[model samples]
Target: MSEGFNEASGSIIVRDLIQVIHEQRAYLSEIDGAIGDGDHGINMDKGFTLTARRMEGQLLGMSESLKLLGDILVEEIGGSMGPLYGTFFKKMARVSKGIGVVDGRVLEQMLESAYQGILTIGDARVGDKTMVDTLDPALQALKLANSAGRGFSDALDAMVEGAHAGWQSTKDMIARVGRASRLGERSRGTLDAGATSCYLIIKTLAQSMKELSK
Candidate 1:
């Protein structure tokens, strides 16, 4: 198996992430509409697309690209998603500083840091049906995979699967935080938009790295 992707290839990889967000925008907003303000996809797509445009014609390392993405999300977008996801990516960039390649261990650290960063800014907990649901489970799964001596690809697979499961789990849960929480029992039976978007982000990251591994 390929060891991992070069950190320098982040420019292209980040664009891929933006594309994934763009494609999922409508779906995300639809889910949000069921419980919250219904603008999750639109807001996320706007930020990610704008960031991709700003990074065009530039060459940057993975960490630099991630920081740029985070900055754009925080500065350009409004609403909870902006600050939450912005901080998440920024923390990921922080932990990845000076890395030559993003291997299993490096990716694990990045995810863990990103998760903590979101937690620092947001009070969401496990089963709260927020992005934390997807993030925490994915991070834990990746950590477990790393501990089991899995290769980067295998570990990434574990992370994605865990994230998907976590996202799905939100459908059975009533929101305990955020705007959706106002709905109380009404929030049940629908997926949390934040968790859905978080899963997409993890899946996009894994797919982009897999492309670079080839």
Candidate 2:
């Protein structure tokens, strides 16, 4: 039963997120091509890479790093995802600020804030084949695990599983929001690009937190 990671050293978590987004750029674009403008990956990669460049040689804590990333995304990235994800990270940063140990409770709070922030800016919901599909379930799993007295590491594992399951669930859903909605039933067979990227972000965060807990 590990407690949690040090917020000061957690900048690596953001770095990992940037790396994953860059690595998955092509895949994300391909997924978006099925029902979007096919630029999700490119746009995400550009924003995250720029964040990484700005973060180089900095010794910021997790909250600071998240805020920086969020700011960059909002200010520099294009399209709807920019504002949505920017709000998500910024909200998480607010909850995480000054937390010494990012334990299960703190993580839950951060995730809830991020989730609510997304809801505030976007109309997307669980069945909408959007990032909300993955984010909401992951937040619920973390919250449920923490409430059940699970260890921090276990809670993170639960969050990852929930995110993965939610991402997979998107394949069977018809788009109810975004450009994909125009496809109607045609959107059912493809995975939502936003959901996939959201899953990756959650998965990366969970894994990084698990490692830091050690």
Best by TM-score: 2
Candidate lDDT scores, in order, read 0.89, 0.93
Can you give the lDDT of residue 67 in candidate 2?
A: 98
Worst lDDT run of 10 residues, candidate 1, spans 5-14
Mind sharing the TM-score for model 1?
0.97
Residue 211 accuracy (lDDT) in model 2: 85
Mark the regions of model 1 whose C-alpha exceeds 4 Å error after superposition: none
The segments of candidate 2 whose C-alpha lies over 4 angstroms from its true place after superposition are none
lDDT of 2 by residue, 99-213 (tens): 8889999999999999989998999988999999999889899999999999998889999999999999999999999999999999999999999999999999998898888
Candidate 2: minimum summed lDDT over ten consecutive residues — where?
A: 1-10
Clashing residue pairs for model 2: none
Candidate with the greatest lDDT versus the true structure:
2
